[model samples]
Target: MTARLNPDLLHRPGLAAYRLSRALALSRIGSWHSYAVIATPRAGMPAMPKGYSYRIAAHMGEFEAVAGVAGVDLAVAQRRLDDGCVCLIASRGAAPVGVTWISLKPVREDEIAALYDCGGRAAWDLGLHIAPEHRASRAFAALWAATGDWLDMHGLAWSLSRIALYNAASLRAHARLDAQLVGRVQALQIGRLQWLRATIGGQTTLHLSGIARPPKLALAAAIMV
Candidate 1:
């Protein structure tokens, strides 16, 4: 099925602008970097800022609450939660202000899978958000550090994430965590035609010539991330 664009995203000015910028940038730059970090304990994993605490959402209600705070769809959040994805929520007192999701299982984006075929030793990190008021307060870094701790506790050796080419802020944040760029992926769509290409460690690995009527769910999930 052809993926229908998420109306919620389009209707929200902030999200619409974000998506438009990404699309425009992608047309010019053509690829995004895939970053991975070994899960060994690192010194100075930032502590949760003065008034914030971190917790893993243990149920759909908690997930919903985090989603509401992050301005994301409850249904999408629930689906990820039910799929065994963990949502780490950062809250001040009773209000959640930041979230990060980690998936123990493989996460595929279009034709590219993150740390694919890793024999259960990898986790994909995505959907990180911090409230506008908290943007420069180290909340995101705190959450990322917490994610690494969680990964270490779970015995996962690798933490993986993707950064779009145009997302300078996210790129710098991941760089601060010392994530290595292990792969790059580019996707293009024109009318009903779609194409994807991936490179790992500077070598081309996945090259899809085209797809007609691409699967909507997978494409939408990729875009949402």
Candidate 2:
């Protein structure tokens, strides 16, 4: 007889609720937590393949390289996620083969309200990631598919996903899932010139011509709409 493996066996139920609560508390304190679940294809592949499993991130530098490749500053991202948790999917006994980060926020009506006019709806925002070492494996795709399932189970069918304009791999993956590009975002930075200054009527005026906001880093949104 062929044995059927139940995926539910690997789930940490109450933990999700606890994390969400913690996130809420942090948000109240002006901090946020990124919450994401590891995406696995199926349980028949064997719970974690002896060394493969999922866990939460304990360090900031671990994501530095990946974030750099994507042209995103981790310092800025941390504040955006409100100091959220980063959940990782690992291979070979849980050694962090890849990662998925999630931020729970309200779907802005100004952004997705138009969807209602087009016979669609709004959902949650998700940030996904995978390590370089595990890029060749089925980890990324599996994680994506699993993420959708998790969203559905959580009663979030109208979820939204965002990908950096420079990340071709992510774009391709989302394309494979039939995610449509909706909009673009630009990133800009601004810095003050401390050394140069002009005295005008006893008021110091700094000459800052190149001191402009950083370029807008484009972000494309995709949804089932």
Candidate 3:
């Protein structure tokens, strides 16, 4: 999780290519891009910012109940349920208003499994979001505060997550929590051909390589559900 960017390359001529790549990936003959975030679990369960109720999904039924309010697809929710991933939910009164998932197993998304490592002391944090209507409140912070408590209880050392480069809001949300950028991944496609460039431990630079097929889901459809 301590992976650092290659400063020399990034500060030189690489910055332009990095920023310009987003435009080239706007179509089918486009690209896939994401960066990974790593954060250590902080102690204490701070009060849910606005008195919103916070709790963990103990079973599939709870996960399903929160799916709609959480704005997560039922199918996607079920897969996470089966994988033993836990969802932290915050409700405004009787309505579920925010959700976040914690996974101790491997990253289910194939595009990134080959790049970031997960398991043991490190856990993968999937979607973390507050409903559109509840965005103006402190529900996002409350949910994260709840997550820190949960992670500390489980003895986890690090929380890892991936966000699409284009998703500025999600990036800022995580950055506000003091997350460190530890991995870089991008896939450039032209018609039927796609190439991949991702973080490989021990390497300090991004290198593009050919791939037979691209992943069906590059990362989260929306940085958060």
Candidate 4:
């Protein structure tokens, strides 16, 4: 019998494309091993242990849960989920404790040069999130650390994660990981006078990116999620 793929899996672009490439590469060299490990020897609070694992965020059930909370419509969420992004979950004895989604991609050549022009080389953007209940847990730290592990293991030398300026928790978490606040970006949106007048008079949110510092914490950073 053929190994059937999950219908939800079919919706992810990064997986749909990368899976084929990864499969061919695996046939010749290595196979994905992380999920099996993730499913094994579950921890009480932190589901993921210190080790390697394959990562992706295209699973439908997980996707829907997050989307529902974030108020993202089903179709849009599915489209992005199909893209080159990933979602991670922390489970305890068959109970889901937490989840996070992330994307793995290289900094654009222009962005790379921009970083170098500013005295940097490589970077990746992290826009995924973890559930609120799991905050401050070992699982949260493990996942953050695993993100770096995935980048290094996959040869994406340098990586970056964006965090909001107002999110003290994330700021502190990344700081623990040794992430640095590189720069900030502004997002603009047109809205009702009521909301705009109360906030920034029609302005949007400003974000910051924190980059990894090699085998340590995230060096450079970007502001998105």
Encode model 1's per-residue lDDT on 90-190: one tens digit a residue. 87767777898887665444223232332354566677888898776767766866786787688754565555554555555555554445544555544
- Higher-ranked by lDDT: 1 or 3: 3
Residue 29 of model 2, lDDT score: 38
Residues 1-225, candidate 3: write the lDDT tens digits.
343323332343334544666566554356554454334335323545666777899578878777766667777777777767889998777777889888776555534323334635466777786788888877877787778767777776457676665555565556666565665566555555555566533234444434543332222211121
Per residue, candidate 2 scores C-alpha lDDT tens digits across 1-225 of 011112232124334434554564656532112111111222112223333444444356555544532223576446434534343334334344555554333321111111111112333334455566666876654455445544444454443443333344544454445443343222111222112222211233333233222111111122232
TM-score of each: 0.67, 0.42, 0.71, 0.45
Q: Give the runs in model 2 whose Cα sits over 4 Å from its true position.
A: 1-93, 106-127, 187-225
Which ten-residue region of model 2 has the weakest summed lDDT? 110-119
Per-candidate clashes come to: 0, 20, 1, 22
Name the best candidate (by TM-score): 3
lDDT of 2 at 211: 27
Candidate number achieving the greatest lDDT relative to the actual structure: 3
**Model 4 stretches astray by more than 4 angstroms:** 1-55, 59-76, 106-128, 131-133, 191-225
Determine the backbone clash count of candidate 3. 1
Local distance difference test, candidate 4: 0.36
Worst lDDT window (10 residues) for model 1? 216-225
C-alpha lDDT (0 to 100) for residue 208 of candidate 3? 40
Candidate with the larger lDDT of 3 and 4: 3
24: Cα error in model 4, Å: 51
Window of ten residues with lowest summed lDDT in model 3: 216-225
Pairs that clash in candidate 3 = 25-31
